[model samples]
Target: MSTLLPISAKTPAGRPRGDGAETAQGLTPAQMARRMAGLEGLVWLDSSRPGEGALSMLTALPCEVLAGRMDTDWQRVEEELEAGQKAGLAGGLFGWAGFDGRFVLGVFPHALVYDHDRRCWFDSGGLAARIPAVAAAAAGSVPRLDFSPQVRREDFLSQVRRAQELIAAGDIYQVNLAHSWQAAWPRGADALSAYQRLRRVSPAPHAAFLDLAGVTVLSASPELFLKMSGREIMTRPIKGTRPRFPGDPARDAASLSALLASEKERAELLMITDLERNDLGRVCEYGSVRVDGLWEVESFAQVFHLVSTVGGLLRPEVSHAAAFRACFPGGSITGAPKKRAMEIIQELEAAPRGLYTGAVGYFGFDGESRWSIAIRTAVREGERVTFHAGSGIVADSVPELEWEETLHKAAGLLAAWSLPR
Candidate 1:
C-alpha cells in the first residue's frame, strides 16, 4: 500500500492547483485506463459526495489475458484461480464482463485506488508514480446526435401486444422488450467528454465508461446488478421507471409518487425480486436468500425507479463464478420466469442484445465485487454508436406507454450527446 501525499499548495488567482491537489484531467477513469498499456483499466462507482466516490485506475496488467467463451471455461478458471497459491488473490480480480459476449474477457491489473475520504492515490504497484504529462482530452462543444431505431415504433408496440397475449395465455407473467437506437459516431468523438457531460446531466451510482480495445462502452446506469463482499452477496434490481422532467420538481415528484403507488409497477417489481431471490438461492446457502428491501423508490437524473435489494450468503461450496453465472443477465432486465421470458424476448426482439444488458465492474482479489446492470449504456464501435432501452411489459401494460418509457429512460443520454429523442 503505497500512498501519495496530497498536494495542498495553493495557486495564485486563476492558476491551476498543485499536483495531487487537482483531480486527474477530467478523464473518466476508463479513458485514463485506455492510455495505459497491457490490460490496464478503471472502475468508477458513481457517488454523490464529491470526494467519497470510488475510482480505481489500473496501470499494470499481471498477465496478457484470459478469456472464456462458455460457462465451463469460466468455471475451470475459477477452480484454477482458487487453487493457485497466490495469497493476496483473496482480494479478487479486476476487469470487465458482458452478458452476451461469447467470452468473459478479463485481466488482473495493478491499480491506483482513490476515494473522497482518502483524498490521495494509493497504488498496489509502482505504476502511479509515473503519471504522464498528457494534454487534457477535449470534447469541444457537445454536438446533437440523431438516432434511428432498429425496431420501428409500430413494430415495438406490436411486440408489446404479443407479450400481453402471451401473458393472457399464461405463458409468462411479464417480458422485457427493447429497441436499439443507433447513430453515426462523430468523427473523433471523445467518449470521455460524452461521459463527463452524461455525469453532469444524469449522474448515477453505477455509471461506468470503458474502452475495451476500440469498442467503447459509455454507461450512466442507475441499477445495480450484483455486489459481493466475502460470503455476502447482494443485488439491487430496478424494474419500474418514470422519467423526470427538466426543472419540473412538481411533475417529477408526481411521477415518483405515481411510480410508487401503481399496483402494476409494484407487481412488476415484486415478480423480479422473487426471481432474483430464486437466482441467489441457487448459489447461496439454503434458507439464506432473502429480500432485504421491496418496492423502494429511488430517484435519478433521468427517471424514477422501483428498486429492491435481494441478498444471500454464498454457500461454502459455491465459487463466485458460480454465483454470478446463476444470477446473471439479471432477472429484472430479462423479466419473470426468467428462461421462458428470455425465449419470448429472443423471438420477438429484432436482434440479439449483445452487450447492452451486460454487467460491468471489477471483481477484486480481496473477494469483493460490484457490477451494474448495463442499462442506459452506449456502445461505440468504429463509425457507429448504438444505445438500447426497454420497458417491462405486463398483462396490463399499454404498448404506447411502454414505448414512451423507453424514450424517457434514454432522454438523458440523448441530451448528454445533444441527440433528439
Candidate 2:
C-alpha cells in the first residue's frame, strides 16, 4: 500500500500556493530530471497551474519500464499489469504507446506522488520527500521556433479526394487523415511554456504535459479517450470541427450554430460514435455499453467540435488493459469500421502517426484512470518538435473543405511554436 503525506503551507516558487484557484506550478519531468539527477524514469502529471484547471499532480519513477509490440499477447500484458497493481504499486502508470504497441508500449512509474485534489501525497516509501522542491521549481521559457507543414495544401487536398473515392467505392464510411508540422528547437527550448501558451489561447479539458524520459509531449486536446472509476468506463470522442472566429461575435455564434446544424458533420460524428459503442461492448459487461451524449458542440480556442460520450460497465473479470485495448487509437481519430479506416490511413498517409493518434493519462493504482486522446499535441526530442492535425472524411466531404479543416485544427499549435516569446 502507498502512504499519503501532507505538505505544509509553504509557498513554492515564491508564490503563495494554497488549495485555491492559483495556477498549479511544478517542474516538467525533463526539468525535474535535470535537477534531481538519477531521475531517468520519472513521470509527473501536473495540473496545478490555474486556468490549466485541475490542481492535482502525480509523480513517480518506474521500478522497471515495460515494453511490448502490438502483436504482443495483450492477455499477458494485462496479467503483468494486474500483478503489479495487486502488489500495491505506489504511483500511477503513464504512457503514450502508439495505437498499438506496434510502435511501443508505455511503462508504469512507481514512487512518491502529490494528490492536490486529495490534499495529500502518496508513495510506498520515502519518495514523497522530494515532491516539495520539484513543485517549487520554476519552468523555463519557450524559445522562438519555426514550423513547416510536411503535407502541402495541394497534397492534402489530393489525399482528401482519394479518401472520398474510397468512401464512394463503399470501402469505408469515414477515414481520419492527418498531416504533420515540424520545427527544430535548440537546447533549452521550454515545452511547458509552449503548452501554457496553447492553453491560454485554447483551453481544453484534456490538456496534458508528459515527459517520458528524454521526450516531452505537450497536448491541448478536447477529446477524452477513456475515463475509469472502478467498473464504470467512458469515452468522449470528437468527430467534427469548425474554426472559431475571434474577430466577430455574431459570426462566431453563427459559425457554431452552423456546425451544430451540419448534416454532413453530424453523419461523421454518428459513424464514429457507433463505432465506439461497438468497441466498448467488446470488454464491457453484457448490455452495459450505451451512448451517453451525442451531437454536442463544444468550443475550444481554435475550433468547435461535435462531441459525444459512450460509456459502459466493465465486466468483473475485465482488466484495465483490456478496457483500453478495445478502444486503442480512439475511433474519433481513426473513423468508422475502425480496422478498414486504419488500413486506408496507413496506405495513404505519408508518415507514421506515432503518438499523435495515441492516448495519454495515468493508470492509477486505485482502479481509476483518465486518458486524453493525443491530438493537438506536440512531441519534442532534443531539438526537433513535431505535431499533427487531421479531419474526418465522409463521402460527401469536399476535398478542399477537409483540407482547410486540418489547417484550422493545426492553427493553435502552430501559433504556439511560431509566436514570439
Best by lDDT: 2
Compared with the true structure, what per-residue lDDT tens digits does model 2 show for residues 1-421?
A: 2233333333323344333112222433234433433344444444423242243444545555455564665565576667767876545556666653533234454443444355444333334344334334466676667888898888888889999899889999999999998888767665666766776666667776666656777887778899888889999999878888888889999889989889999988888889999999998988999998999877777798899999999999887777887679799999878899999999899998878988877676667677888898888877889999998998888888888898899888877668464
Best model number under TM-score: 1
| lDDT of each residue in 337-368, candidate 1, tens digit only | 88899899889999888778878776665566
| Local error of candidate 2 at residue 263 (angstroms) | 0.5
Query: RMSD in Å for candidate 2, one decimal?
Result: 5.2
Model 1 clash count equals 13
Worst window of 10 by summed lDDT in candidate 2? 20-29
Model 1 segments beyond 4 Å from truth?
1-62, 76-85, 89-92, 133-144, 419-421
Candidate 1 residue-wise lDDT at 122 = 48
Model 2 misplaced regions, further than 4 Å: 1-39, 42-55, 73-77, 100-127, 132-138, 419-421
